[model samples]
Target: MKYRIIELSVLIIAVISVYAGLSYARQAAGGQTIQKGGLVADVRAKKIGDIVTILINENARASNNNATQTNKQNQLEATGDFGNSFLNNLSGGVSAQTQNQYRGSGQVSTSGTFTMQITASIIKVKEDGNFIIRGSREVETNGEKVVTVVEGVIRPGDISRDNTISSSKIADARIFHQGTGVSTQAHRPGLFTRILNWIF
Candidate 1:
């Protein structure tokens, strides 16, 4: 009975030691994460309100062409026979004809590209371990002010060690850029053009 008790104790201790070694090995393989910030260099963003740098590179292109044509024609003719009478000179033959034609064509093409960077805040943590982030930026150059805003959802796995994520990895992204001042007005249509467009 004494030997059996001793063997059981030895088995339990060996099992516990093996489990501890495995736990340590796993931690070493994955590296350690410092949960505390401020004094330590913890760059990963894990919670709401944490900021992360976002790199944006997006582009768009579109083109369209259309044409229409229509044509219509109608003709009517009448002839009468008269012998040795003045009516023969005036009513010998009568003819009428009508024709209509229309043709129209149009073409349009547009393309644009945007590349920038902004610091975004984590707004929400999804149930599936995704993050909803929003960011905005404004820049002014020689009395021209441009504002940019971005919002999207990103997976934690896509974030780099420096807490930066590329725009391509983001899903359901909304990006807007607008400018004001002389440069903006220069690109806008003149009053005459606007009036013509409205009338048409």
Candidate 2:
């Protein structure tokens, strides 16, 4: 009986100690404990290892054009010659004209658009309340492989209640998309075309 009493007393003491420690920690952190939901989990990324879903919707376009023109002309004329050389009854006149012109024009235009969705990992947290995130994904279909990489800084307020943020809100963002394989090569220029392009 005495041994049972000792064991029970020890268990009680441990429980009380745990409760006190938890309460103190909660007060220090200014957080509330939800008994039903276990704990009120933060929906926002706060520290390293916390992940934020990134809604990636981006578009890009580029166009270029050039033109050049050149023109030149020259003329010469003379009169009242041979008045003193021959019989004075004959008149001489000379006229000459020269002209040169050049014209050149060129135009080139290109545009592209891309859209994707990716989940990023929070790699760092700054003192200024910024989260540095990096993410990458690769997909292969029909013998063609595509790779995408993204990294950037984000603010906590930009994160939605569902722990998602738009790619547009990311600052200093770097996103790269590339592909390889038969399909990619098919879309690219052939060997002859590439040779011509290199020569030009």
Candidate 3:
């Protein structure tokens, strides 16, 4: 009976100590005070730009049996809806015509994850009544993915009477070819050169 009494007393003391410690912690936390081991931390966040991706399947067709066929199929397996929104915004309000030029008859897939960093500049008007847009976009796509950037000057005033421009009038054209940790700048056009590109 005496041993039982001693054990009961010890248990009561332990419970009372735990209750006291909990009460003290609650008061300290309410005031955002530092307690025995560590203090509560206040976190801050900053605003920054984002990179996004999207899955796009264009020129889709299905037979009566419902087997799907498409000219291009690109899937983006990234977290968040940022990728979808980015592609939608760039595609211009879900209209078909805006994204048509970028499409091709054969399958041109751009799947996989890519980190895109973009910076753009524009010259509103040229002396020859033409506008110039200079954009620098860095896209890290596939392992062997490469992009050849071209810079050229054109004279709109030199058009012939038939309203057709001559190709020989290209005074200066520079190309910056980049791929696989290798970069080269040359006056000649690279293998992936879209010679005639216009937006009206």
Candidate 4:
């Protein structure tokens, strides 16, 4: 009977201790206060692994024209009045004329524009609050695939309130756009042609 009473007392003590600990935690949580106006700032990417949207708006244009023309003419004439008998026959007239002309013209022009949006993950944070980011996106439509890749460093201040940044604002940026499909293949030279060009 005494051993049974001892076991019951120990069990009651354990239950009371658990209840006291729970009560203390609840009181501690309730006593904490939230500061006003502290949550008004927009969420921004500040840590490694955070994601940021990149707006791609790019345009390029180029043109060249070259023209050349050259012309030359030369004439030689000699006349001597030799009243003598044999020298007069040989000195009748001598004339020579030469002319040359050349003309060349060439022109080349190219223009392109790319616009899209992509998300990049911050891979590293610099000591000055800059971010190193890298990301890629691919889309397939009607058996055609287009791929875009971007990597660069960006300052935190450049990020907008919506946690987005323009691709042009990125420093030391590397961007690539590629397409693969039947159309692209048709535009490229054949394998045999390419090999022949390389050999020559």
Number of backbone clashes in candidate 2: 0
- Candidate 2 lDDT, 1-200, residue by residue in tens: 99999999999999999999999998866643354343455567778989888888777664434444444456676667465755345444665675544444433333565667888999999889899999889998777676888899999999987789999999999987666766434434456545544543
Clashing residue pairs, backbone N/CA/C < 3 A, model 3: 53-83
Please rank every candidate by TM-score, starting with the best: 4, 2, 1, 3
Model 1 residue 102 distance off true place after TM-score fit, in angstroms: 33
Better of 2 and 4 by TM-score: 4
lDDT of 3 by residue, 1-200 (tens): 99999999999999999999999999978666554323223211111121111111123332221122223323333333345565545533332321112322222324343333223233344565542423344446543445544334444454333333332343353334355422112222333433222221
lDDT for model 4, please. 0.79
Q: For every candidate structure, what is the RMSD over all alpha carbons to the true structure, in angstroms?
A: 17.7, 14.4, 31.4, 13.4
Cα deviation in Å at residue 109, candidate 2? 12
Off-target runs (Cα >4 Å) in candidate 3 are 1-122, 128-130, 133-142, 157-168, 181-200
Candidates' lDDT values, in order?
0.79, 0.74, 0.38, 0.79
For model 4, how does the per-residue alpha-carbon lDDT over 9-96 read when each residue is reduced to its tens digit?
Answer: 9999999999999999987766553322334556778899999999988885656555656556677776787566455676446667
Q: For candidate 1, what's the RMSD? A: 17.7
Give the lDDT of residue 100 in candidate 3: 12
- Candidate 1 regions off by >4 Å? 1-40, 60-113, 183-200
What are the clash counts of all predictions, listed in order? 0, 0, 1, 0
